[model samples]
Target: MLDFLKPPVLTIQEFFILAGRTIRSIPRRPHYLNDLLMQMDIIGVGSLPIVLLTGFFSGVVMGLQMSRALQTYGAVSQTGPIVAITLVREMGPVLTAVAAAGRNSSGIASELGSMKVTEQIDAMRALGTDPILKLVKPRFLATSFMLPCLTAIADFVGMIGGYIIAIGLLHLTSAEYWNGAYRALEYDDLAQGLIKPFIFGMVVSLVGCFYGLRTTGGTQGVGRATTQAVVVAIVWIFALNALITKIFVSR
Candidate 1:
């Protein structure tokens, strides 16, 4: 009767166990800096184009939408500030993380899942090399470091997109738009913007690795793991965003 619940319960338990071990392993020796750098290139550099496009179009769309809404109140001039705040506080981090979850999470799962199914992971274990140390650590560190950088880039590019709409369509001055956008950000806003992506990065990488490491059933299981990694990472990203936002708002 409760068979359906067993998989989920077991998954949750194993996820925490993996997370705990990853965290503990951070301080231990046998650092794989080379692997970390390679992952940074893959996770950070490879994600640039998608992140750029997502940020730009999001800002453009936000400006268009907010313009109409604000025009009703004769506050169309405030579009820059509104766009800046919205992107920095919510859209930039969330969207970037989602893009990353979609791209990198699935990739991680597929790669690791393939390794597991083909017995590469088993081979590593037999050779006394910890798969978690070589694989998970690099990805986890890379994502955590790169996500905030990506969010910042996204935020800036988004502001530029909003600027185009503001100046070109709304007829606002450059000074007004830039000033409003710049002044709207406080330390708290900046903190939240960076913090959210960092946390989301950790979750994304870990979720991908978790599903990857547990993969079974050969090639079919690899596909399944890839799909699940993306879906689960996204769901957790949104959930964590809400919780973190609530905490920030309460303060």
Candidate 2:
């Protein structure tokens, strides 16, 4: 009872202590870098197909909707640029992060939870291996590297989708669509979109690893941890996206 009433300050202190321990573990097991690179391939490269497909469809839908809405204003030609701007400045990074949170975060939590349940993490500790360096670091590094790349790919594919729909379905000239897209797609827009994914990646990986590390009570606890990791990662990612967008757009 009294324990439950402990000051919230202790929570912050505990977080810092855990973070320090995690950071300190990084230098002791350098091979985690190699494992991290492999995970990047799995999470980033392998995710490309789905990202591309989704981006393409999203762009097509945007173009179609915008075309219909703007035809009354005789501004149908603006569809391509609008689609490009939206994809590069918002949708690409946001969608990619959501997908990654669902896929990678869940997988990381489940895998690590299973390891914890099986006492494999304990075994590793007994073998003098730091789990944070060997497990958490690799995932953190992989997610950080892969997220930006995925966002970039999604942006590109989404633009292409807009192009196809604009030119083919809307009866707009390909040259006109391309021209508007090229003119409107500013470097700042791309940079703004790209920046958010790195933060999202970090959040996803950290939350997943944190929940997994804290897993207990055998199988049921592991399952709960995995579920919680996914839920928290998704909520944080969306909230962060909104905050970032407010910062950029409000400015």
Candidate 3:
């Protein structure tokens, strides 16, 4: 029991150390603006298509499923508000973060793990450049900046998907669906939607960087780090989502 606790505790300590150094380096010299932009493009723009696809399908499914339930009370026409609130308050941010965790986390881990195994990180340190500064900082900043944007896009696309089902399948008028959706959202719901993604972005990026930097055993270690990064990032995303939602709901 104690042995198991030791590994986790040690890992947690190291993770926070990496996180601290990354944050501390942010305002320091030798800023990697180009790398930051590249990561933004990679983690942000590259994630757009998948985010759109998932958001749309999630809304479509929600509309279809909820209609069946609403039929019992003859409230099927209320599908827009239901879908909008669900997506904006919960589904959009969670799904978007999970997707980014799968995509960006694995990429970050694999890329950094490879660099670690090949001695590139070591070489950088030898050359007096900080790996945390050059590599981790940009990725962290980019993911934190972009995940919220992706979540917002996903929420909009999901609403559109809900609209399609409302008009096309449910035979509801466009005004009914759009108006219901627009009105259902409040400032609190919007705030919850945005905050979850920002926290998730930090968790995902930092977890990836942590596992990647600690990788060993050459190629096999890289593979292992990549897998761990995805799994851990996803787990943290779900766990954090639950915790955050609980706090918001309590308020």
lDDT (Cα atoms) of all candidates against the true structure = 0.95, 0.83, 0.94
The ten-residue window of minimal lDDT in model 3 covers: 1-10
What alpha-carbon RMSD in Å does predicted model 1 have with respect to the real structure? 0.9
User: TM-score per candidate, in order?
Assistant: 0.98, 0.89, 0.98
lDDT of 1: 0.95
Candidate 2 runs further than 4 Å off:
1-31
Return the lDDT, model 1, position 113: 97
Q: Rank the candidates by TM-score, best first.
A: 1, 3, 2
Query: How far is 121's C-alpha from truth in model 3 (Å)?
Result: 0.3
Error of 2 at 67 (Å): 1.3
Model 1 residue 165 distance off true place after TM-score fit, in angstroms: 0.3
Residues 1-251 of candidate 2 have per-residue lDDT tens digits of 67865654674465456556666766664576578788888788877887888888888888888988988899989987899899988889888888888888888888898898899999999998878888888888788789989998888888888888888878889888889988998878877888899888887887788778778888899889889888888888889988988888887
- Per-candidate clash tally: 0, 0, 0
- Which residue pairs collide, candidate 2? none
